[model samples]
Target: MGKSHVLVIPFPAQGHVIPMMELSQRLIEQGVKVTFVNTEVIHNKIVTSNWINKDGVDDDLRHMVSIPDGLDPCEDRNDIVKLAKSISQNMPGKFEELIESVDKEDDTKITCIIADFNMAWAIRVAKKKGIKPAAFWSASVITLASVLSVEKLIDDGIINEKGMVLKDEMIRLSDSMLPMKPTNMFWVCFEDPALSEVAFQIVLAAKQASELTEWVLCNSTTELEAATFSMYPQLSPIGPLLASNRLADQTGHFWKEDTTCLAWLDQQPACSVIYIAFGSFTLFNQNQFEELAFGLELSNKPFLWVVRPGMTKETATIFPDGYMERIGSRGKIVSWAPQQKVLAHPSVACFVSHCGWNSTLEGVTNGLPFLCWPYFSDQFQDETYICDIWKTGLGLNKDERGIITREEIKSKIEVLFNNGMFRANALDIKEKVASSIAKGGCSHSNFNKFFEWIHEKDS
Candidate 1:
């Protein structure tokens, strides 16, 4: 057999790329030759972003190849709806051509494709090119069960073809899984036409993956989602594909990490810090930003916050007068922090997060209790799992203004630390997460099985 060469593609978002990137590095560690592919814009951002640390990986391994996303240079790829549309409409042909060129030039021919589920068209394209295709569902498997059930949902009149929930209710994906708010079906669950288009696109992609693929690679563990895994036997859970477990801290981030946070964390007493980060894409309005700042101040807790560029909506100012000075050395804020380092820090006790799956798993991986403030898409679902089913997190409720107030934030912190109940729960879940990734653990065994599938005889 020729070398096991795989073409890896992600959906071009920080969240999507990081897990796929982790998977790529893991494959490389297992002696698979990998061609890592990303959209041209995302690749440039990773190269230019201040948060990346590139010295750790080999130059050959670090080499990234890009394909056009079919958007004008001036287009804002940050706009999720337009970006999703562009990727769906554009990347398949470009990727197909890249594969052909690679097959001719490289000694090892392309044997398979491991693509992010959002880019389902790549699987269809792989079929045409006669390459094996596997889809990576980047979010929780419970979320996948919800997405893969789209057709059943439509048949039951629960959701429309456009991905809209026809009735306002909770959606129970499986008997053992936590039920979800119908409105939080996904990012596309919104009634807005633009968001609806993206939702439908996701549904279509899910359909393609369920119908066309033989094995679905998920970034979750069977222990974490046992019921979901049992419900869909085709999904092989090989994750919490955390950088820590894989021995790679270079999971792709679009911003430079502030190493200073580590030094800052080292000074604080054990479990005394509250680390706050609202992932890459969540933007805040001026009022909401000020409210959060005041909320953090009111809590009077030692905190490390990531306030990225363009995070606030044309607010002209993100913090109120004297806020930073009031907190003084008690709080640390940067555009980005090496998250895994901070989460793993002994001083970091509670997490104020956007409930993105990566952040959720990071919290789980590090055993940090959560204060869930979800931002968009499937975040609500992950939060539900954390706070509702898993009981490792506390969801912060928005006020009458439909905002998370300073008082609300302050109160939640006090409540979370009250007798340290949530921390105890988090530690229990942490044991499961650790065991899932340890040698001969569930994820380790599942990953070995996945590699076997990759090396299986097609005939």
Candidate 2:
């Protein structure tokens, strides 16, 4: 048999792209040929940001390619529903064309397709071309279970065919699974009813396509969600798929990471810095932004904050009056940060996070307790795991005005810091995560099996 060649595609968002890239890296290490696909926009951002060539060494086994997402240049990519619609309408044909072109150029024809669960349509495309299809889920196993259980949810009268929650209540998929709010269901979390319905349709399509997949790989471990993994025995966990596990820098970042913060972190005392970062999609109004700034100041502890370019809706991220001067050298603010390294820094005490899955895994692996301030979708579910299930984090509460005030932030910091159990629990979870990725561990064994499957010849 010739070399095992695979085409890997992610859902085009940063959170999805990063883990898929990490998985691609593992494939490259095993001497497999990989074609990593991204949308044109995402491809440009990653290449221009210098992430692909950061080390100045290119891997011959891996190739990065881009396909149109079916949106015009001026279209708003941030609108999830619109992006989903465009991708569903346009990508399959473009993807098939790319595969044909690739086959004409490369001797090792594409043998398999590994697609993000959200982009399961590609699995059908693979099947049409006589290629093996595998689904990759970058979020929690329970979240995947929830999406896959759409029919069960509908049969139970919890949600309708369109994913609308008929009854507003908490639900448990099984006796062993944790309870989840209907409003927190991934499809229904959007505030706009129309958008929610569209998202529901996209999810339904994904579920149907996912049924054609031969393997379902998840970026989680049984140690973290034992019951959920046990409930769906087919969903294989081969993660916390971090670059740190291989001692490499992470790739697939849309923004260039500022490494200067590492120098500043070096100067701080051990476990003294409050690290705050919300992932790419989070946005805040000016009032809330100022409250967060003031709250960090109120803590009076050293801090490192990732204030992304569009973090706030305002034209500029305006801080409180004289805020920079008042805080002085105690805080470091960067547009984007190297989060994995930042969390691994000994000077960092805990995470004030938006609870995105990538951030959750990064914080947990680094043994940092969390102050969860989730914005939307799956984030609330992750917070439940952190605060309620694992007891390794605390959730920040909002006031009657729907604002998380400076006082609330300050108080949570105080409460989190005053308690030692949170840190201890975090450390314990960290150890389990490390063990899972080590030799003879669950994730390690699963990954080995996946590797073998990827190389297996057709009967």
Write candidate 1's Cα lDDT for 1-459 as tens digits.
545788999988889999888888888787777888888888777767632344322444433678999899999876768877787778878898899998898887888898888888888888888889888889988878877788788898888877766888776777777787877877455647687777677767766765787878889987677888988888888889888744448578887778898898889999889899999888899989988888888887898999988898884645898787899999999988889988998999999999999999999888888999988778998888888777887998887889988889899898887757788888888898788878899788888877777767532
Per residue, candidate 2 scores C-alpha lDDT tens digits across 170-272 of 9999999999999998889998988899878867877898889878889999889999999999888999889975544667889988999999999999999
lDDT agreement with native, every candidate: 0.82, 0.91
Best by lDDT: 2
Off by over 4 Å in 2: 53-57, 246-248
Q: What range of 10 consecutive residues in model 1 has the weakest lDDT sum?
A: 50-59
Looking at candidate 1, what is the lDDT of residue 101? 90
Clashes of 1: 5
TM-score (C-alpha) between model 1 and the true structure: 0.95
lDDT of 2 at 255: 91
Model 1 scores a C-alpha lDDT of 0.82
TM-score of 2: 0.97
Clash pairs for candidate 1: 50-256, 51-255, 51-256, 51-257, 295-406
